[model samples]
Target: MIIEGNDPTVEPSFTLSNRLARQLWNWVWLFLFRPSPRPMHAWRAFLLRAFGASVGTDVHVYPAVRIWAPWHLEIGNNVGIADGVTLYNMNRLRIGDYAVISQGAHLCGGSHDYNAANFQLIAEPITVENHAWICAEAFISHGVTLPAGAVVAARSVVNKTLQASWTVYAGVPARPIGKRTQHEH
Candidate 1:
């Protein structure tokens, strides 16, 4: 399966018209705002919303938060993305309900194929399941599936599929460390 690679129907190299518009918009936004830190609120929401983020009701995004492309982010209900959480989602990033992404967490949805010519980066969709807890400073790689109620411990590096619910994962390339509060779900 193509993890987060654009849907097969979509072309990789954009036509001139599409490229111009995208460049123009990116330039406009970059020019309009200085890249600096500040408190976040409705303005950020408006900006993300404008970029095509399917943000659900009352979703909280902090200022100083960086998103590569808002258009690819999809969050379900009651998701809490804490301050400094970086979602570098070039492809689809699907977060289920009540997912808590803590501060400094990175949902990296792009990586280069080291063996490929020029090491072209490939984007993959990340699926964070319902009621999952990605603790502070954790890094989740592209195409990873955090099953429902999974708990990723702080500073963990997750690169594989985790299926158990409410289980704690921590390590470089994270593995199960312990059980979580949730069970049978």
Candidate 2:
């Protein structure tokens, strides 16, 4: 859980360390990561690695992408995360090799338990398997797992684990719309 408190109504939601780290990261992002040129993928990767992220080779993470916590990220080889993407990784978030996270996509890794009196925070892992495509402006909710070769259509919303591989899902609360032809790349 991101926040653990007996009485959240009065207590702080995040720990002091967590808040401090995020403050430091925000400064780094403003001064270094966000201002860097688009082609400097390796440099950005290096910065993320320095902050405890496990990033693989040939990963293209754009300068405009917003990452909540680098320590919660694990990205594999050749994964392309485009500009305007928001990776709200309050929990562990993984992107497998060859996955493409299109521009404006939002992968949220945390939520609140509405049933709780204080609406307790709940952090859950999110996974995008190899060759998966999260299309432009899509919203992926907490604890979701997109299987290998799965495609989420533009502006789609996915809140649960996808069942099939190589399938195309679309619409709100995305459903399988078609099958994608799997190819070895």
Candidate 3:
């Protein structure tokens, strides 16, 4: 069997200026924001907004939530991101109104292109629509969109877009398991 070799000459995915800004912001996020107490949601939101995130009112972002690039993040009103949730948004990541991302859940927006010899970095946007709920420890892959009122069960891995609203999805690759009835909030 022949083995593939990685190319050394591929260009970097981000510009030098962008890298510098990101590194600086990352340092700020680590020491200043990450260690803040749980009730300091407004402080965290302030920091994220300072770094270019379009955050809406009443957004609850726990201290342990890690955002790769705040400049690419857009959070809508009343969204709840629990502790240890990772928003790995190399590209744009939009969380709509009333969306809930549970503890330890990961919304990953970046991946490497396996077809490329150098394993070139590829990024896509992830959109969690209004009223969607991503359960604890769920993994949402790059480019996946969770529709309005969609529910991802605990520890589920979602790779594709869940188009139907008010549905519950679970398991590896996340298939729809049941319908969620609409309720008064």
Instruction: Point out where model 2 deviates above 4 Å.
Output: 6-9
lDDT of 1 by residue, 69-94 (tens): 67787887777787788888767998
Q: Where in model 3 is the C-alpha error above 4 Å?
A: 1-12
- 47-135: candidate 3 lDDT, tens digit per residue: 99999999999999998899988999999999999999999998899999999999999999988787786777778899999999999
Residue 48 displacement (Å), model 3: 0.5
Assess every candidate by TM-score.
0.78, 0.97, 0.92
- How many clashes in each candidate? 3, 0, 0
Candidate 1 residue runs with Cα over 4 Å from true position: 1-40, 183-185
Q: List the global CA lDDT of all models.
A: 0.76, 0.94, 0.90
Ranking by TM-score: 2, 3, 1
Q: Per-residue lDDT for 104-133 in model 2, tens only?
A: 999999888899888888889999999999
Model 2 residue 116 distance off true place after TM-score fit, in angstroms = 0.5
Candidate 1: pairs in clash: 3-124, 4-125, 149-166
